[model samples]
Target: MCGIVAATAQRDVAPLLIAGLKALEYRGYDSAGLAVLDGGQIRRVRAKGKVREMEALYRADPFPGGTGIAHTRWATHGVPNEANAHPHVAGRVAIVHNGIIENYADLRARLQAGGRAFTSETDTEVIAALVDERLAAGLDLREAVLAVVRELEGAYAIAVIDRNAPGRVVGARRGAPLLVGLGIGENFLGSDAQALVQVTHRVIYLAEDDVVEITRESVRIHTLDGTPVERPVHESELSADAVERGEYRHYMQKEIFEQPRAVADTLEARLGPHGVLPNIFGAGGDELLAKVRGLHIVACGTSYHAGLVAKYWIEEYAHLPVGVEVASEYRYRDAVVPPDTLFVAISQSGETADTLAAMRESKRRGYLGTLAICNVPESSVVREADLRLMTRAGPEIGVASTKAFTTQLAALALLALQLAHQRGLDADRYAGLCAQLAHLPRAIEDALALEPAIVALAERFIPRQHALFLGRGVQYPVALEGALKLKEISYIHAEAYPAGELKHGPLALVDESMPVVAVAPGGPLLEKLKSNLQEVRARGGELIVFAEGEAGMDGNPARGALLRVASGGDFIAPAVFTVPLQLLAYHVAVLRGTDVDQPRNLAKSVTVE
Candidate 1:
């Protein structure tokens, strides 16, 4: 994923664009660039590093213009360098793009045949040159964009500004995220609302194949065929504080602690004192729930782990057969998504490339109903789905997700309870679980107090090159997420194994140098988890246990550290127990001197496959 921000007829927009880019830097930080229409010519500046570096470069050689487009790139087709940065310019056209053009090689060959030269080895540069070629052949900016898009085949959100049309910017999205911020006098375009939230909260989320022509005072929407279309502009209720880190050392840490507030927010206004969902989805819910034969939970990364936990919840409570698939793999497999099957996509950013693509495929295949559990209200996933469950985890700034994952679990758990009620499952059991769910925020607050101990534990393990995480049942997904967070930020060689699976193959790697983080929550699997911990301890592996406050350790001297979560009911423990693991990863990464906000080789959003 990359971040894009464009503004037309906005004087001194560079500073604003930079601020927006900084807000979006979590999405990408490999390189940053900006292109402004200056004196009827394109003026571009780029830096090979973070947004701050680009800001310094731009300040030294100011590219003053009223209309501009900026990008913070996550390297895809090329190395992370100034030459490979976005706002790729070709002749009079400058372009900033998110997503990949799969047919770029063929397009490059055809363009080379036409004697078009390329500078950077990026698929985005090909788009800029193609637009430039079309513009030279008597097509206007919008016409050229449409023509070029016709030749492309891939997911992309392209925003172009031509020197000849200094006041106009054309943006097109095909299976990628693009939003138009409805501001006074000056209009804005960004890959996400976070990029434009500071300037305007009113936005129009562009659908696939929708092209927007933005000028100083007006925004026109049209189909690829040039027919004018109407789109709804919605006001976002997101507050400025939602995006702030407050007093935490890093956004990751702040997000870890915000899990309590976020979970509370997701549960608010929907559930009553009796633990009933307030008929939110209405008639659609009944119709869909009645006919649903099975469910396909599609997501990527941490969201995928959430779906794993959801499978347990829904199957146990809702009595529904559920399959949790990695979105990227789900589309290509011979999986069955019947007409009455419910397709649920989980994503924090909502612009997750594979998840969005999988959702589209499910719709094309005629899934009964599509639902998106997302954090962003009007994100592509939310807009495309028939029903939306918005997680109230506001702007997750860390590249490796923390609060968003927990919030998604909280929302999905509630949805499971709702489904259980509709399906006439054990109502009392479901109600008890819901009551526990309601107390999760407070349990999470208590869990967050373990951070100081976790930070101390992290100091002993951050320097280790290899680590392993193990858990059983629902905690397996948390173990996977914990391992992922460590690998994502700290560059540690970490792997998660369902405790039972360790004996199959992974036990061979356990040694003195390997640190094993075991999620041994108090449950039926507690003894098995303890046995697994002992297996690691027998192999001279360091052990870190995440257990309840009263969990008995059986006097194992090998239990190097214990992160005791506050005592809570079993149903709420996942939400609360996840807090310490998130802090452990964050503190470890920070101690390793890694960029905690924008991790290397990772972007906040997975907008491209």
Candidate 2:
């Protein structure tokens, strides 16, 4: 996980590069640096901490240049220090890189043997040395870059600049994402289109192993092996306002409240007059759903929880066998991919490293088709899939996902309805589910309105050290998600279990210091969940329940502790139930004085394995 921004423009581009790096800072902010080519030399400034530190250093003594490259690094090769930050320089070549170079040791040894010295403990410096050696050995800047790229042994998206070539910037991508931003009398490069959206909406997403060379006036693309290629410049639909916090205290809170709109946006096109059609997932989605023999849902983190929820919906409604797996474990294992199985990848940022890798593995193992339910239209996962469903959650900047997760559930619900329609489901049942889907936005709004109560619920947990969450059947994943949210933000040790499993093991951990939160959706399992809550009460544990209003525990003494969450329908109740849990975690984190947006040791996107 890292970020890169480069530009060659008609005027001083250092400010532009700084702004782009600041925008991409969510990707990673461990260390930041910039290299700008001025009158016949490359000047670089690197710092060990947040982007603001680099910004301060630059402001103290500015380095302005017409062409430059900047990076915010999530450290992989060495400790995050000035020496280990990006913008590593050798000879006249300066480079900023995102991915690991597997054979960096060998290349470093070769370069060192050739009398090339390295100043930083990074794989990027090795590339710089190799390119510098090539340039020294009678090759032009672009020629040296292409030559060195041919010998690279691992995934990397890099931007290189040569002092001799003052007006040019060379960029290459193999695995990590890279894109070019188009503008009049200027051109730009970034790890994602979001960084450049403020500068230009027109972008060309570079394919795997594509090398691009950009100048002040023109842009050219070539294959890694020197073959010229043409790539379409698509207009990015995300606006600068989407990434802003507006009046919200934090991006996470803004995203959490945006659930109502996010779910509505996701369901906007899917709910048509003829009930749920399959074309929402691009062309041939209906055909794929009809022919699918089984389904494998793959994702990581919050996306994995969404897939787990989908497993319940797909199997119950579509009546097909569905297996959900964490993308990290799924990619490494020799998973059984049944013939004609539709491999589904769910990710908020389609560039999630593990999820994308799992999707590629599914393709390699001959899955019938690959489907990606992702928010970003030009994400690597969407591009790799044969069928794609774009979740209209737009740009989710928070490290802890909120809107993205809810919108994914909406998309998955539509997919399940389409599959059920193909499997000859009863018309009344189909129409009911469609209406439930339509009601989700309003239900989520009602849940958001209950925030003041959830805030009070959160206050009770401020002194608690650990917690347990319980639910049965379809709501079990909701419990898991609740536990995940609590742990992610508030730094509380929380665990979730099926209500029945509390007696088997988890009950032992319940005590006065440990709180128990239950997701009690009014379902067939309601009585069983009530019994489980009684067990927690008997164990002298404080209980917090996110329950449906008509669950009929009306006169119970736990009413003070129980907060009612809205239900769109039994099918879409999970999305509504998610709101209170998210708010609880957010408010608790605020009270605990922890960083809600940038939690420690976590980056927004896991772009590296």
TM per candidate comes to: 0.96, 0.96
Backbone-clash count (model 1): 0
Please report the candidate that would top lDDT against the real structure.
Answer: 2
Backbone clashes for every candidate come to: 0, 0
TM-score of 2: 0.96
Residues 133-191, candidate 1, lDDT per residue (tens digit)? 99999999999999999888988998999998978999999877898998888999998
All models: lDDT? Answer: 0.86, 0.88
Where does candidate 1 stray beyond 4 Å? 549-559
Model 1: lDDT of residue 579: 79
Lowest-scoring 10 consecutive residues by lDDT in candidate 1? 549-558
For residues 415-439, write the lDDT of model 2, one tens digit per residue. Answer: 8998888998889998988888899
